[model samples]
Target: MSASVERWLTLEGLSNVRDVGGLPLRGGGTTRGGVLLRSESLHFCTPGDVEHLVDVFGLKLVLDLRTRREIERDGPTAVARAGVETVALTFIPEDGRELPETDGVDPLVHIYLGYLRNRPDNVVAAVRRLAAVDAGPALVHCAAGKDRTGTLVALVLDAVGVERDAVVADYALSGEQIEAMFRRWTTASGEPMPADLTPHIPRAAAMAEVLATLDAEHGTDGAGGAAGWLLAHGLDEADLEHLRKRLTESS
Candidate 1:
């Protein structure tokens, strides 16, 4: 493992955030930390957070998944240092929903799982970017660190040969991490936790369901898993190697 991975591994900021690294793949590989990351919107990171990501982590690429309106609302990430590349990708909207409907991060995940079913193009476009450029330590994100981020991360995981079940587990962990974060404090009125503020279990469950659907359509075969996704996105043998070289593959 590298020092950069240590800097961002399992990072739990006040807002929803995490490093989607260190998970075991189906065969015998694990995603290296700092090579890839997933998180909620960067609209609210403080200066300290940005400094940590830039100075300590050395992020070379950022895949922002928010809508144009969302970016206007949140403002751009303040990472102006050299050597960091920011790529904006707007996921194709299907099922008539713009993004996650409920504030619940998990339910919003449902939107993405379904979104990828008919619109593999969105996923492919992302892969195409990976093929065209070398964005090391890519961080993909949307609002609340779920939905668009999860869908893209799931595809990335699949592309990297991670088992479908393992991908779902990683997706579910986001809910647990965020839910636990919300439960830490309370209001003076002692009011029951607002549904909006609490973690969204339904959203997580829906995300799981979507993954199951993908399995039903496609199995554990590497062709339909990571390799298929690459081929679908028009990646050649060299492109696949380029991606594999970027993933963490050690103890």
Candidate 2:
């Protein structure tokens, strides 16, 4: 297995949980483990999974990207019962399209780009929350942890100077667990996997294209890319710096 896939945490209830740590930064280091993790929704977290997150990971906060309606439909998550503070920052606005209809472009790519173009404010807020000094060892999640979560993770990884390829690789790691995720979801919700989950499976090319587009449209002088996009939106130098220090370790 690839080193990236090894980062997956073995949880009893969740299938797609992985630390964003150990990814190479552009400067010369790896992201620190136990600092930033990404996962699918925690609504199905088993008692053991909750204990593992709380005891083993020392999870201090949860950045829930699921919308309020999703939470209501799925019922409460075990993270709340574990006493972890979950800040719900809905990345896609409530009325936003779940699968953006596009003619010639990857739907995931279109929706990701839409997040950057349409809901930049929400994206910035997620970064600000993650950068908070007190949010120790936080985990971020949406429904599948592939689209909304992946886009947000890409932005955070990029802002911290993580190499673009490494960022994309991490995003694509979700694809490896897509089948398991669907099965887990089906068991929890008592519904079969959606008729067409293929489109939702993450693709490295899609994330790469999105990053390239960010550099094109949001980058300053054709350079900044994700960091530039964040600064352009609302995050300042301090926010980026905090994220870098909190999540990375110099080798």
Candidate 3:
């Protein structure tokens, strides 16, 4: 994996932040930075963090893949740099999307499991939006920035030729930031997780299992995983090639 350990060490109060620039891909090169940025939901981000993103990183767009209910519960995040935009790139567009329907579930793990079930289709949609927007320094996030965000990141990285292990490594990076907050959110009583919280270890494991299955079914080097997902969305081989050229490095 090509992640910069030092750069990945930034914080904005909201946990689960990352850069996709340095991962090892199939070829000698790495996925380029300044193209795609990933992170947890900015719902609780501090102004300083927003400044770092805007002034330091020059972030131009914020893609939110969160379900509608999550937005209502937490409300919009306040990143006070004025000019950065927030787009409702939610994966589930069902006029009404409800919380996992579980009263006392661990909010982090449960919501992702729910996302896996109810809005699996949202996965490709979110990726398409990210590509089509062409917004530089774009940041994509879901509440806790693990499941929805991680899935989307996986798609983008796979398209860019990043290896499965590297992709998984980039994803698990969130655990250090995510778990700390989850522990804080869960009281001594261990109230059922907030539903928006991410059970870093287990959730990442589950996502890895899904991707591994995809690899087993569709050869890792061929039209499976990201390529397969795109095709399953009805995209043809030619479309895939064009997308690769447009969004990734040339082979």
| Candidate 2 similarity to native, TM-score | 0.92
lDDT of each: 0.61, 0.86, 0.65
Question: For residues 165-224, what per-residue lDDT tens digits would candidate 3 score against the true structure?
Answer: 777777777676765667545653486666664335535565566566556655455634
- Work out the TM-score per prediction: 0.73, 0.92, 0.74
Give the lDDT of residue 94 in candidate 3: 58
Candidate 1 TM-score to native = 0.73
Screening candidate 2 with a backbone cut-off below 3 angstroms (N, C-alpha, C), the clashing residue pairs are none
Name the regions of candidate 2 deviating beyond 4 angstroms. Answer: 96-103, 189-197, 220-224
Better of 1 and 3 by TM-score: 3
> Candidate 1 regions off by >4 Å?
1-14, 80-83, 92-110, 117-119, 130-133, 179-193, 196-199, 202-205, 218-226
**How well is each residue in 23-118 modelled by candidate 1, as lDDT tens digits?**
777678787676666777665456777766777777767777766677776566775334467777767552345553556555554566545654
Clashes of each: 4, 0, 8
lDDT of 2 by residue, 1-251 (tens): 97876798999889889999899988799998889889999987999999999999999989888888998888778888768998888876787556556879877688888877777888899999899888788999999898899999998898787888999989998988888888876876799888877776788999999999888877775344988889888898898889888988899
